[model samples]
Target: MIENPGILFSVLAFLCAIGPLVFIHEMGHYTAGRFFGIKADAFSIGFGREIAGWTDRLGTRWKIGWLPLGGYVKFAGDMNPAGVPDAAWLALPAAERERTFQAKPLWQRAIVVAAGPFVNLALAVLILAGFAYAYGVDRTPPVIDQVAAGTPAAAAGLAPGDRIVAIDGVAMATFSDLAKFALIRPGQAVAVTVQRDDRRQAMPLTIGTVRQRDRFGNEYRIGRLGIAGGKPVYAPVSLIEAPLAGVRATAEIVSGTVETLGQIISGRRSIDELGGPIRIAKVSGEQMSLGWPAFVWLLALLSINLGFINLLPVPLLDGGHLLFYAVEAVRRRPLEPQAQEWAFRGGLAAVLLLMLVVTFNDLGAVGVWQRLAGLIG
Candidate 1:
């Protein structure tokens, strides 16, 4: 048995979580480019100096780099991983230019770039489908199992057998919907409709608010009706329906992420909730300890987030490349080389800055900085 198993588990779990997703993303670019008859000069996992590499018959260099956080595909005629064209590319012979990525038709380029994020989404759907096919999902129905005394549910005359049908006229499908509805509207008044003995009745109730603390001592305010769900029911779904369920599940994650981001941006939520690599690693280990199934679910969620982030219209990302192509199509020409260079530089700076900030937050969350400060003191 290993001492400090949590540290070991976190490291391994983080790698397992990131490795497959990165490969899927980069392989998407490589596969799509080759399919379009564009030659790939190199494909690498990670950045910096190459640790190991091999060249194939097609002259594509496949390599693993020192860093393992992400990867990229270098299409022929690209100056770097950003897919910018070089002077050598522009001066190539006509036949050679044909094999280069930039020389391809606009639609093909877009497909090659968009393929990475698309594969990520597809991978998420497939992973989720597999899980659904195997064990289905555990869910709590809208029927109230317990109404805590002195809470909104008890005051509103909600009983143990009552089934919540709607909140403010919005039909709720599950117990989760009830929680979701109340959590964001702390201290607000809302009408909840319930079905009892096949008769529906609406009850106006005030959402109770409470300050909750995490193990890390971070505080948050949330609303509650103070009702608990009964035992979770696991529905065994067929394979055919699994993929459809996967689609729905993936969409829910995306929508929830977008909503959270919107809340943070609108100042309705705190930015402190944003996490980085360390937080992910910690969560990965915690999930792995739960079960392999839970770990797989974490990977699926991470895959979806990877796809979403890469699709942002910021330079140095797949979405940024697509943005450039869109502008080219509209303006009937590519942006000036200098302009493109400066844009990529700015994007790199922005990405690096974000990484630094997130890393700092992670350090703070894990008490690394505080511990060091104590030592110094």
Candidate 2:
């Protein structure tokens, strides 16, 4: 049992991190379905054979699956966990059909499909709000305190006393803002507006790129502006203001994520940076070791990512379902069954391919290939 605490912690930490998030995500769908008078056949966490569960008063079979990867709430008419409509169920009488998800109006179906991801996003915002209320918010100004030699800031003619006013005309209110803006735009040129001698001057600067490794040896390729900010100052956030602060913080995270994806798509960033379950488990365990605060913070960040990813327009994902619903709304009818079948098949393939790529990346990051090579040698 004591053979490897790290592996044990990683497994446990992964469960702890993923379990509730999945529960909440499925719960969102369940609650929304119930609100529309739709029946849920089952609520299962993870994906395979049942581990344990109980039937609810509403007749929903609440179960835990052996696979701890993800969970789903099966509605009355769902063919499977992916929420495909059962053709036989759809052929039922009108009175029976009223209680099924597909029988609902287009708008209601859209809301039901969207509720899960929105709930995840809302959960993240609340988590951030709690942190802001507890520890306050950073109010540090974006004034340059240092410019490292042989760096972008040095090349851009930035000086220590210069006060950063904006980047490409977007006002930089805080040092955090500046950092967030730069972090997602590595190797991109931007106009930096700085206030010097009571005058503002905009100068073109190319962001630098750097590869860094964490304590756990996970690699990251991020932007570096090569300038340091003045000492930070944090102001206490009141209860009323905390939610707004949380929203702003959440927006920054969303913006950064979007920018990073854009960079990856544009070939400005490496696809190797994508991570999967293994990397998440490793990081989750490391954060758990640090303390609850760190772990909880990771939870919030992951929650946001989960919400964002599910919104992508790919079949088998929440976003894909929404996309289909959108087409139904526009065409005034659902897509043909054959078309949907093929779309879902394609979506499944895409999702599986992505999982394979990220898993390969995770293995490489953990040096699994190196260890195997060493053994072979």
Candidate 3:
């Protein structure tokens, strides 16, 4: 049994958030292909039966799909939506072949395939920049409001009304800078500099570590000084600075994701943090509840992830197509059709397997099995 309203909202929010992004991504390929004289057979935003459709003058069938999760643009000379070519495509009239995706020059094909991910990247950057420009960055000085008694802050003589000037010798531009600096170096001593009553003071403090777990069951230790944050003040940004700040923030997010993946690969981080469509829907709903800005932020982040993941050299993905093109370029001919077929099959299997694992992780995060076990117990 499922909760109607909750599940409905989650599904709806997930669709609303994902549908446009997927369409935009596919359009990147479609538009590029069209620009290079590569004809599109169909442009469908979703899978399965068409909800609504119209045939364009260009002989392309454009339609909405019943499923709102993802979409694709089937190109001329393509065997399938995944852009694999077939013998029939090569047997087409010479003039028609010129407009088919497979008949395009290697460089053109590369551009068309790469366009999807590149468009996603551009969308994220643009969204971030637009939001930052409209609502300048939230700035709050790292001022301690209340120092918890018996905590490391109190032990270090940190008092209320004191402002954190720096942590670990790094300038604390905002309270987040301090928290990030402390959290990453749990159980480590950090050099703290504070501004007290117009006087600057430097003190050494050992950060206390506290074990914390998220709803996903991933546990980690974070350094805590037990100081409550003060009120935030939004700093207005100049038109020129907003986009630049957005770029910086986007870069930081990409870098952080890379670092996290690296840690997980090295076994320094848990694979349990990996999530799939379920997790995404849950997060999307939660973010939607938080408000539009936050939801948009999630969209931007997801866009970045989509772009990044699609750029990976995995089969059945845009990155995989790029990889194939690279090899073809080097060899002055394409890979054997049988070899490409096997590669696609393997890639499809791998993608589905990965999705299954992430969905299981999502179920675990939701505590479905835990509840069943509790009932049995």
Candidate 4:
């Protein structure tokens, strides 16, 4: 029997973390649709059987479901949560079609579809900005204070007192910037520019890779540059500056995600590194145990990731809808309904495959496969 309080807490924390994010994402779609005079049939916080629900004056059924995995806003004419237009509704009289999502102008429909992911992105930015305003921004200079022997820094002939000014021609304004750039590019070669005394020189080196475990025993393989920087420094950010700081932080996260995905696509990184709901739940619980601050930070990070993922050009995702809209705009007509149906089917299969792969990776991460092997042996 599982008796660990921590395990239970992790499950609760996972719900606490994901539930609101999903609600907010669905709310974004709901609100945007309403703004354009489109009627929604349902605003559901999960899929499958309804746990509880009530109908609002607008006749929208607001409900919670047992699954708690994700949520969706079902527009008046949607055939399902994926928002495919119902052929029956499409054939309805023009007067009845006015309030349907399909009846909206192309631009309005695009906005409604795009709003969900953009709202997630905006939420992340706001949360980060709040943090910056409450605390401050890191202002540590990118000067190398020590270069560990036999490491990448040493191999590249980098020395103490050399200041990192750029990596691959991109400016590094702070030590944090340097770390962020290198962290996602494990074992990747890069050109590092540094200023030693009065002369600036560029050196080529491969970032070292290291396997490390977090406090909760979660393992990660990350880039390591075996160099130390000077003492930490932080500067207070004003309310006006906080938003900018948040934007910069969000941009960094986006770039890092893109870089990591690119590496994974190119087979430079192991597929095992990909994580799913299980990994997220584990991390969420760990972060919650740390403190509210840590948990909140994780929330913001995950929110940004949620937003970014929805923007990808995959069918059944917000991006996929946008892609169809883009094609519709260019073609001066919608694609054949048959083609769209097939595309959605393909997308659904791809999405399901991804979920399975990530879940398998998550199981491996939690030692489920190892335990099964031991039992079999």
TM-scores for the candidates: 0.86, 0.95, 0.79, 0.96
**Model 4, which residues run further than 4 Å from truth?**
1-5, 80-87
lDDT of 1 by residue, 50-109 (tens): 999999999999999988889988887886545657877789999989999988988999
lDDT per model vs. reference = 0.86, 0.89, 0.83, 0.89
Top candidate when judged by TM-score against the true structure: 4
Compose the digit string of candidate 2's lDDT tens values, residues 80-193: 544545768768888877898877888988898899989999999999999999999999989899999999999999999899999999899999888888877778899999
lDDT of 1 at 330: 100
Q: How many times do residue backbones clash in model 4?
A: 0
In terms of lDDT, which candidate is stronger, 1 or 2?
Answer: 2
Worst 10 residues of 3 by lDDT: 1-10
Clashing pairs in 3: none
Identify the runs in model 3 with alpha carbons over 4 angstroms from their true place. 1-5, 80-86, 138-234
Return whichever of 1 and 3 wins on lDDT.
Answer: 1
Residue-level error in angstroms, candidate 1, position 151 = 3.7
